[model samples]
Each structure stands twice: as structure tokens, then as C-alpha cells.
Target: MPFKKLHTNILERLERKDITTPTPFQSRSIPVIKSGANVFCAAPKDSGKTTTLILTTLHKLKCEAVGNAPRAVVLVENKEKALELYQAFLTYTKYNSLRVYVGYEELHIDIQKSEIFEGVDILISTPKTMNKLFLLNGVSTSQLKIFSIDDAGFLIQKSDSSAIISITQSIQKCQYVLYSEELHPKLKRFESYFMEHSKIIQI
Candidate 1:
């Protein structure tokens, strides 16, 4: 079953998808997230890390009634990965009022307009696209409370450290979650920046 701590509505939605038991990562990280702590986790792909990310993020938004303007920003490696995460996010928040925007390069420059960001509670994007959004969107991330990097190893490999820091530094007093399929030496600097004194979960 989904953890008793999770929202009932989410459990019902998961039930519709035949998702009952929590994966080890899901179980271990959910409570840590519930406590609003920073997390650096390593788990294999398709090990339900995305599900945990969705659940924790959705639950937090649902509980706190945070105002719009993309309170949570999840950084993936590319447009394809952003779309994939957006799909899963939609599946989990289907019954909720949350809005998710995918910031890919293919999208027209019109996104710089404020109308494009209306009611947007979560943002899924690449590091480059995120940087551009910050420059052009005129959107305020002051209310953002969750910053997630889905493929930290890959991001480090691409030398996206500066772009990542720029976004994280803009937000204050938010929870951070970093997950990677494999850990590399390059990821150490990324870990230290956000997960300082935070818990580490390895699977």
C-alpha cells in the first residue's frame, strides 16, 4: 500500500494505476521528504524514483496550498526527459489543480510572455532552457520550495554546474532532491552545493 502518510487522494489515483506497494527508494525517501529535508539519492533507472518524486512533490503542494508560479522545478537532461517527467507528473496529479510546464527549446519564444506561465506550479526543463526562462520569462521563483535534479551524473558530465547553481541560488529555504542512476566524481560538487549536511540514500 502507499504509505499511510501520503494523501488519500493520491493513493486512490495510484490504486487506479495498480500501484500498491512502495519501492524501497519510495519508502525510504518519502518520510525524509515529508520532513522537508534535502536528499541525494542513487538508484537504478526504472526503480520508481520518478514515482517517489511525483508523490512527494504533489503531496507537499497539496498540503501547503502554495500559490502558483512554478513552486517546484525539476531539471532533467533534455527535452525528451522533460516530456517523460511531465507525463508522469500528469498521471499522478490528474485530479489536482496543479499545472506543469515543459520548457524545451522547440517551444516558441512566446513563452517569454507571462500568459504562458499562468497557474504553472511545476516546471520541467533542461539547464539551458531554464536559464533562458529566467532571463526572458519575467517569472518570479521566490515562492519555489522544491528543486530537483533528476540526472545529476548526466548533468555533471555535461558541465551544467553553473546553470544549475543559478537556479538553485534564486530560490531560498526549499527542499532539494538529486537522483542519479550512477554516481561519478563530478557529482560531488553538485552534491555539496545543495545536499550539504543532508541525508544520502543509496540503492
Candidate 2:
């Protein structure tokens, strides 16, 4: 896998951080992702999908330096899941100059009280929060490089029709990666929508 062959910078970063071996999901998906293809990965929990996405997003961000308009990489997941992912990304990219933010159910409350997502490069959010932010014009999707959905099937099943529509409408040109444990029938419909040229890899 060409993509699995980490770049010199990324490999050096991993080595400095004591991350030598790639996980199963990373070994399989990284190569395909680096090939610049849309990917849909189905694997069990704790299979390293999150780490793969974080690393890939970092690689993309580094390759295409953020423009003046603040390019962002978005991850949409559940509220409970957001915290874990946020912490993981923070730990993984500690040495990198990446800015991470968490947008979940009550992000508005924080925004109303104080500034929340200023200078955020990576956003981990839920569907509802993302829909609200899209509606309020708080975040711009135009500069997004990576649009990821972790536990995508679960999120789609839990999301309202309008929310789903809003999120899909906001992100048009992003390279998408959808991860889930099981592929639901409902999520398959999105293949024709957001993901046209997609590869489904079961781990």
C-alpha cells in the first residue's frame, strides 16, 4: 500500500512519538487513502480507524497548507464519542502544529457565552451541532480538505432528515471517509450522494 508507506516527516513524527507499527486498519486504509480515493471502512471498535483518520488528515493538511481562509478537517460523531476522539487527536498530534476543536450538542451554549472555535483547524462534531453551525454560518465548509464520519451508519440512523441534508449540502468538495462497524442499508444510499468513487474495506 503506497499510502501505508508513511511519508518521511510522518514516519519521523511517529518514531519521535514512539509509534512504530501500524494497526491493522491503518495498514490497510492508509495506502488506499494516500492514493487519493474516497474510502468507506467497516471495522469493529478499537480497530484504529480514528488514528488512521487523524494521521491522514494531518498529512493532507501538511501537504496543502491552510489557506488564508482557515482550512479545516471535520469529523462528525456522537457526543460521547467526541471527547475520546478529541483527546486521542490531541495526544497523537501533540508535536504537530495542528489545532483541534470539539463541536457537539451544546456548542452553541458555549459560543453564546464565549468564543469557542477560533483558529480551529480540526473540528470533531456531532450532526446536530454541525447542522446548527452551518445554519448560523459559524464554520465554513468551503475550505475543508477531509470530511470524515466516524460510526457513520450510527450517526445517519440517529440524525434527522433535515440535519443530514444540511450537513451533506455544506460539504461538497471534501474527500470523504466513512467508518463504521457494520454497513447499514440506509447508509448505502449516501454512497451515490457524498461518495461516488468509494472503496468499501471490511477489517
Candidate 3:
């Protein structure tokens, strides 16, 4: 009940995990996200930012249903984070009948050419893998809705940031959400370019 206005199905999923109250970060940031605005979230680690992003993304996409195209693209630093976030999405979308996909760097040769993103609602991957997938015509961002960057500070420091730029450039209608434990000047530059009239929430 505390996570008011969240989808009933989402609440049901959270109920299974005995999660009834929104985290401090979630309480402040989720409302901004539900307004369909670009969001820059500054929160400490283990503050539930990931869960907030996943739940709000699921809700946003559900409000306007989706086809086979990938609607949400999440960029993280590595495959481990991708897999972890993919699992988080699985929890939120448990009853929503959505597909979640994670790209693997090792398979960039054998399967990246084809099987990387068969059909996905939410896509989680490292930037280079996504760049490669795009180069090989394995994926498209023509219908993207949410372009999320978790651990923005780390990801922006890498050369693979170029890959993220390329992908975001292709997005037609999308909401950008960047979350980081700390923000530096370089990351702030990214925030300025990616988000327009965004709501900044620090917790």
C-alpha cells in the first residue's frame, strides 16, 4: 500500500518477496519517473535504485503495452551486472508476461550474430556488446522507451560510452534514467546531453 499507484500486478510480485514499503529513493524517484520524465537519481549503494528502475520501467511499458521489439535498454558496466539486473526485472515482470534478455560478451562470436536478442521487453547488456549487436544488425532501438544507465559513473568512464551514444541516437521516443552512487563532472556532462528537463533526485 505504501508504494501507491504502482500496478496491482507489480505489487503482487513484490508481495511475494514481502516488500511492502518503498525505499526512500524509490519513494522520491518513482513519482518523477511515473510522470514520464527523464530522471537523474543520486543514491547510495543498496538503496533500492535498481528495484525502483525495474518496477517503474515495467509500469511505464505496461501503460502502453509492447510488441516483440525491445522497449527498455539498460546499460551496465559488465555482464555480471547485466545478469543481476535481468533477474531483478524477472521479479517485477513475473506476472506481466514480458520477455527479458541479457547479452553475453563471450557469445559475441557464435551467437551474437543472431541469437543475442530474439525477443525482449527489457534488454540488459554491456555497452560494447550492444554496440557489436548493432554493428552486426542483431538488434535495433527503433522502438525503445526507456534508456537506463545504472552505475553511470563507471560506465561513462569507459570508451564504450561511444556505443551508448550511438544506441541512444537511434531511439525515437525514450525516457533516459541515469542512476549513480556518486556523480562526477564527466558523468554530469553525460546527464546534460542525455536528459532534457529531467528531475534530479538525491537520497
- For candidate 3, what's the RMSD? 2.1
Q: What ranges in model 2 sit over 4 Å off?
A: 1-4, 7-9, 63-70, 109-117, 156-162
TM-score of every candidate relative to the true structure: 0.90, 0.85, 0.90
Tens-digit per-residue lDDT, 150-190, candidate 3: 88877655586677777666667789998999765666676
Best by lDDT: 3
* Residue 143 in model 2: lDDT: 73
Q: Evaluate model 1: give its TM-score.
A: 0.90
How accurate locally is residue 46 in candidate 2, as Cα lDDT from 0 to 100?
87
For residue 31, give model 3's deviation from the true position in Å. Answer: 0.4
What TM-score number comes out for model 3?
0.90
User: Which scores better on TM-score, 2 or 3?
Assistant: 3
Candidates 1 and 2 compared: the better one by lDDT is 1
lDDT of 1 by residue, 27-91 (tens): 77788877888887788987888888888888877733356677888999888898999998888
Which pairs clash (backbone N, Cα, C closer than 3 Å) in model 2? 3-31, 4-31
